[model samples]
Target: MPYRILKRKDLIPGQTILMVVDAPMIASKSRPGNFVILRVSDKGERIPLTIADADAAAGTITIVFLVVGKTTAHLATLREGEDILDVCGPLGRPTHIEKSGPVICVGGGTGIAAMHHIAKGHHQAGNRVVAVIGARNKDLLLFCDELGSFCPEVLIATDDGSRGHKGFVTELLKSRLEEDKEIAEVVAVGPVPMMEAVAKVTLPFGVKTTVSLNSIMVDGIGMCGACRCTVGGKVRFACVDGPEFDGHAVDFQELKMRLGQFRTEEKISLEKFRGQS
Candidate 1:
């Protein structure tokens, strides 16, 4: 069935778009770390996006995505009241949240939106949630207001010193870990490099760290093997085993190599698409 877009907003005008889609079943079933595979048109390739938020009572699931390729560019053109050709989800394993202690969630770029849901889950589970989010500048930051609503501490890092700390999110996280000895876990969702940095920062602290993988996916199920990655010296599928895994155990080098395998083709496709448009 086609999913209707109930609302749409440009979180970073022309670069990032947020959409609230009407998908009651998915919304009700969705939990932290779950994602959806959507198609803008019948001929379009399916792309997986993490669910930024879900309101079961409202039957809506929010998705935030960066317009990095042809598919996302097309999706950005859609306005409120339009319909998505297909949206199959609440896929992947939900985050493992339990009342342990303070949990720090680190996010960069568009991943801040995805981290919002997980941080909210931790908050609802009675865990003290500390959100550390980063962007190039204050204008590029996202979900600060929403995260601030529930989180007791919302720390920020901007590369250009536009606001908050004038450094990387890792710097804030490292300092926080040093000051808070009782922190139970650290979760990161963002670019591969950022997640890698988070894992490194949390390593010496002995805090359990989780990182969400945004692997390239074809089918939203394990059958495709397209989202396969090595975690803890074993092969696992991001779509089924987890989109969230032990950060220290993941093979970042392999994941980074795989993510870039199609960069050339993706660029060509986006260029041809733009030419047509």
Candidate 2:
């Protein structure tokens, strides 16, 4: 069955889009950190997106994506009533949520949407959730209201000094870690560089840090060696083993290289797609 888009919202108007899709099976099984691989058309390339939110009762799953390449640009053109050709998921391991002490969740750019669900999970588990999110400016920030609805403390940062802290999210994170000695863990979801910075900030404190990696994925299964990354000394597949891993152990440098491998070709493809449109 085709996955139908039930609702659509332009979170950033042409830059970021959010879709609530009707996919009962995937919604029912989806958890924080789980992602779905979808194809916009029969001939389109498969792309994996994190389940921003899932409502089993409503039989819908929310997906938020940034329009960065050809497939995403094509997907953004779809309307609320359109049908997605195929959606295969609730793939990858779920985030490990426990009733620990305080937990800090840091998100940057579009990654705030993905971090929202994980923070909700921690809140539901009776753990104190502190959300720290950042963007280039107030206009670029996302999911602030959603996170503030549940999280006890929602901290924000913007590079242009248009919002809360006039610096990076890591600065707020470091301050929080220093003040709250009871912080249990730190979870970060965003660009590789942001995640790397989070890991670095948390390292001195020795706080357990988890990061969600956005690797180049083909088949959303372990069979394809495309999503492999080095965590510590071992190679792990982001699709099957985890999209989440110990941030301190991950090799962000290697992940950055792999992610940029297709930039040249992707830019050409997106240009051609736009020309056709």
Candidate 3:
């Protein structure tokens, strides 16, 4: 049976959308930090997207994605009741969720879209979830209402000061760290630089930190090695091993550089696709 788009919510007009697909097995098995690789058509390139939410009872899972390239732009064109060719996953090791007290989860930009599920997982585990989320501006921010429902406290920041604190999310995180909240652990997921900055800010406090890496992937499995990165001096695959890792031990600088390697090619591919259209 084809995986049908059960529901769709256009979040940022041309930028991002939330899709609920009919994938029961994947939904039942997926956990926070797990991702899926999807192909919109026979020739479509497989794209990895983190699971934003899942409802096993409904046999559907939610995925939020930005329309940055050919594949995503194509995916966005798909409307409700349309079918996606393949939706393969629940891949990547699940986040090591635990009862770590008073945890801080920081999500910058599109990362905030996926943060709610991860934060919900922690909240259900008895951890007080304090969320700090930001985007370049208020128009780009997401998940504040839903995340705020489960989390007793939610903090927001915007680069343009259209809504919350007028600065980077990292600046807000730094302020919270200084407040003596005894934050037991931190989870930062966003742009590579944002995650790196969060790790650096929490380093001096010696707070345990984990970052959900968004390294590019091909197969969304170990076979391709496209998502390989140096973590704790060992080669780790973001697909099979982890989408989340020890922030202090991860080599963010290396990951950052590696993420840049395909940008030019990606841009070219995007341009070519646009020209053809």
Question: Least accurate stretch of 10 residues (summed lDDT) in model 3?
Answer: 108-117
What candidate 3 gets wrong by more than 4 Å, as runs, is none
Q: Candidate 2 residues 189-276, lDDT tens each? A: 9989999999999999999999999999999889989999999989999998899999999999999999999898998999999999
Ranked by lDDT from best down, the candidates are: 1, 2, 3
| Candidate 3 clash pair list | none
Those runs of model 1 whose alpha carbons end farther than 4 Å from true positions after fitting are none
lDDT of 1 by residue, 84-179 (tens): 999999999999999999999999999999999999999999999999999999999999999999998999999999999999999999999989
**Residue range 1-277, candidate 3, lDDT tens digits:** 5799989998889897999999999999989889999898788789999999999889899999999898998888899999989989899998888887999999987888788889999999999999999998898989989998999989999988999899998889898999956899999888888999999999998999999988889998799899999898999998888889999989888888888998888898889878987
Give model 2's TM-score versus the native structure. 0.99
**Candidate 1, 200: how far from true, in Å?**
0.6
- The lDDT values for all models are 0.96, 0.96, 0.90
Q: Which ten residues in a row have the lowest lDDT in candidate 2?
A: 219-228
lDDT of 1 at 37: 97
Where's the lowest-lDDT run of ten residues in candidate 1? Answer: 219-228
How many residue pairs collide in each prediction?
0, 0, 0
Once model 1 is optimally superposed onto the true structure by TM-score, how far is the C-alpha of residue 149 displaced, in angstroms?
0.4
lDDT of 2: 0.96
| lDDT pick, better of 1 and 3 | 1
Candidate 2 at residue 42, lDDT? Answer: 91
